[model samples]
Target: MDKIVLLPDLAKQDNFYQENYLLFLRRKLRAAKIPCQLYLINENTSDNESFVAINNLTDTYYLFDQILGINTLSNPLFLADLKIPTDLIPNFQDSRTDSVTFWQGEQRVLTVKLNKFGWVRQVVSYQSDCFIQDNYDVRGFKITTEYFDKYTSQVLKKEWFNNYGELIMTQQNSSIVIAANQRKRFRQATYNSELEIVKEFLLQHVDDKTLFIADTDPDTINLRLTLPEQFRFCFLITDSATVPVGQNIGRFHNIKYAFRTVSLRDDFLQIAPEVKQEDCQLITPVIEKANLSLSNKLVAKIIYWHTGEILPALIKDYLNQLLTIMSEQKDVELVIDATEVLQAVILQQLNLLIKDAGEKTKPAPINTPAVVNRVSCQTLAFQEEKKLMRQARIYLDTGTKSNFTLQLEALQAGIPQFARQSNGLITPEVNGDLVADNGALPEQLSLFLRSLDKWNNSVIENTRIIEQMKPSQVVEQWRELL
Candidate 1:
């Protein structure tokens, strides 16, 4: 049987590897009982087992560092094994920078940084003369250890080690020496780029039966050009913004097809007429169906926002409109679905706007005795956001770039969506509205808010629209593609 191999751009901490199509493909393949392997190219030091645990991926996986010689090391290294000189066993601190400090009595002895996976990323030991930092892999073994001059606080040299604590590589200045063992034969090699090392490793694995589906990144592009022309490969197009259409077609003889969503496929073909339509396969994502039956109907309305890198001016307008709408009718809230950092920034800007607007705008009289703010907004994580989307009356997408995933989520949730730009999901006055002019948002939004019948009709239409991109249908498409 021909096994599908998923190659991601990179598998670093907080890179949203969870949301990548490579894992998505693996998951679908797993459900269908088809053989698939996630081949990681990048050097990931974090505890990737956390990622594997979260995704239920315990079977076939190939890590770049583990493949070389660490495969035989039975005992995995953990933070506990390091046994940093500390009075108390310290808990991993909730840190945005992914670091924590430890003290041995008065002297600060050690500092440990964690990856987003909450595993020990790097451990730095403070000595009287110098500080040494150790970088570990997911296997809980040190990959690299660097010595720094305590006086200058500059790196002296880095020693790379295999999982069994064998010195395999070293780096000083611009020089790097790799000690590779093939068939129990040891040899030292100097390479200009790590891609050379990767090519050598991949050469041992590449066969006629294996299918490599990789992200269309620069690294993969370079790899495709470097590799033998006989190997079959596919470019998984996640976003069209990054991928150039006409360039890759005849550049490599082995690139069999490009996999993308229906909308992305059309967009790709439209941009580059030189590229054939059949070259890009339509493989829509598997979006889980929201169980609306068990969901509670919101007493207050919600405006879900998935616009990435939100401008303060754009948000202020939405807040002003939301506040005005709230003053007239108190049952409304704005939910900005974004990262924690972005959420904080948006809230800080909105607070200033609310303070200024609150002075001028009078609070609307309601039946409740207690006073309430006219402007109401909050942010939720993706999991909570998923639940919130079930009760969302309207979804606002006014960013310059179209967020296809969020658009699909809104479509699945049966929310009346509005977008600055249009995609296959957005149908003006049918399932959702298109915001051609930002100035007309107030009137258009007000019309939708006033008409309950129109809102319900759109929700019904959204149900019909989302049928084409169901998970089962998408998995079937994958079965066909594979």
Candidate 2:
């Protein structure tokens, strides 16, 4: 649907905030091509009218942007134009149900609450657009599109590719817009050698090969969304791969694709129209099983988590939220003595992340497959869960204490201390955003771990210390490779 989305900043904390909510929303929108008006709300969520008149309701994407630390008001443009006018500032109060507060002669307050930002709420009726977690699906043709026809190359929009044989598309627009209005220049530095190579490859191996060439590496994840909430894009595609039915994915650039082996020969023509609609419907019915296995939510979550690095701050935040959601479940214990399992996992894989990254001296980092496949992420996650389960069982055996503090004590007593230790050193690639790399400890959550310097070496540490240590070890190993 071609529409604008009005997203309000939804967070409550004691410190700084960010536009992560907005970034999360924009990523989903960009991937889905669900265009909408972006009303970036400040402390103004309680206009009530914003949530009111919620007509043409498609879906309201609510992104929870806490976990990773980011400054929400860091933009200079917003600092210049936005203001805190005292007159518009609202006075808030707790909305008690059946409160006898009158506005006029007939109006009696039914349901309304004063939120943290001093905003007023009245007649709260909300309609949410489908809430998608995030977009990690980068699947689609990434053409050398910026240049020649954008199907095969990264060319400037206008300066001149006239000498480069086939000009599929020239400028950004089809019309003759004046130079002042135009934002992109038509210029691609192709002398036909690039195309010559591709054509040769297609002709030689058309029947049996797959060529995966990307202008940019696809391994690194993009997580700069804590600020700007919208994605501006230019795109094209060359081939169409079927997106499973009932799934929502975002847009792409350079979408046009080429068929490797289709020709205008009589043999090809003989098979072209052979398959009838009757045959198509017969196979369509069987695709439901495959469609159910493809999950949009999983695609989004994995993308966001993997983008930052081995231990993304977004993931810890996500896990915390998951725990909150699952808090009522009596069986699922959130805390685990992460040390022993983590140490086992890291020790199991350290030979790969640390030893191999520096072993080879190519100017750019090469993909160390041995390190990458050391342990499947699923295994680590399950190990942590199993440890938590084992401890929770011990706690349950003692009459399943209901007190929160007592439960924490039970958890601490059960927390396993990791046996392996090292004066930690990590690779820079641990956090993906190369500059944010810190060799100290490792994972984003590692900062909250046991301090070896603080311990006298003889004192027993809390069980959570072990939880904090081993993940850091794995993180450090990855950092070493980075």
Candidate 3:
């Protein structure tokens, strides 16, 4: 059956709720190892605007513009009032099990923490007997049959026992911090396709670990409140991602992992392709098929950087710069000095940039204490590290600076991650992944590169951009001009 998705009651009233909800839904599902994606179906309509989410039951995809709505498409109320689609009728919603039946009694609002791991729902007004399915019926996006039968059995379902159903699993005790833009340069995005692909990709990659994200309120925040039970997490690191409405459903649902603290990995960043950060992973598949002129590799770097732990405003800007350069300059890498010292140089330059940011304003990275310990103490056998180095020898494509920096930093800093060298050498073991037996680490590493600019424009524009960007608009705006 196709799952239905909904904006949180508070988010329905607030336009700003989207971003936080996005991060919220992402972290919980990923942490629980549940196969899910936050589908943002932004529709360009004649009257106002709207974005709807549908769950993917299959491998099929759809464009957002094709969805139908009467009022300003952005309003969930307008959507709810509309007739249910005939095609969606067979989605298998059992009114008896799906909705809580209310007896003839005064309704009371209850704030129930649904998913034990960490999923929670904000106050919902209903009779005690009435069952309220968390936003599943409305905002959820479902892929067509092609999507379901194709990815279901193998990609998402196969891991059912390990990822989605684990009572508790061993975490690598290490972390991968990424930097990515909040937005992309592509004129149009195929909503369902991007979300599900990345969801599957992450499930196939990454080890057991909790995910903490920095975001805004409304859309992203309500996501926590709307998640169904069995979908919760150990912790949630949030900023804001909500959508406010005049009706004022309730306070934004906020939850922090009990013993978890946001740790500062670096005041800096990197990427994991589809394998690293969820932020870039979110847009990765969509960006891949788009006809944008940008080198898929370079944009991957931007996606990587955009997945970082710094200020998202910066990440957003850097992504724009990346796209601008990629669109105009047929070439992204202008050969500079090549040496093993390249990684060290890149790290030094990035540190210098963060130092400069301190001169102007007090900076704060996510304070994850446990994460700091893990980042400070990860290990690998000499043979394993050597094997990864050998694989690294095969996949590196460009930028001696970025490649060396990502891998060397992981090793030097004691992170489990690895990198590809400038020679197109892959060193997959250096990658810290168990999934990529075939592809190089570049695609994933590049995702980390753009983080500097994507998360904190002030720092990137003031420092890193001067070094990494080409001589063009790549140095410019979208709240990330660096």
Report residue 249 deviation for candidate 3 (angstroms).
Answer: 12
- Candidate 1's TM-score: 0.75
Q: Mind giving the per-residue lDDT tens digits that candidate 3 earns over 34-74?
A: 44433342222111212223323232122231222111112
lDDT of 3: 0.26
Tens digits of lDDT, candidate 1, 224-249: 77877777788776675545644664
- Clashes in candidate 1: how many? 0
TM-score of each: 0.75, 0.18, 0.18
Candidate 1 local Cα displacement, residue 360, angstroms: 8.1
Q: Pick the candidate with the highest lDDT.
A: 1
Candidate 3 C-alpha error for residue 402, in Å: 18
Which runs in model 3 stand beyond 4 Å of their true positions? 1-34, 43-66, 69-218, 222-409, 412-482
Clashes of each: 0, 49, 134
* All candidates in order of TM-score, best leading: 1, 2, 3
Write model 2 residue lDDT over 1-482, tens digit each, in one string.
22333333233110101222233333444455545443322211233233322212345321211101111322111111323332332333344431112232333212233323233332221113211111110111111112233233333233211112222222344322223322232122222322222233223322211211111111100111111223221111111222111011122221111111122111222333432222111000000011111111121111111111223343333333323322322222223222344435433443443455567642222224332332223322433433333233122111111122222222233321211111111112221111122322123222112222322121133332324434334334222321
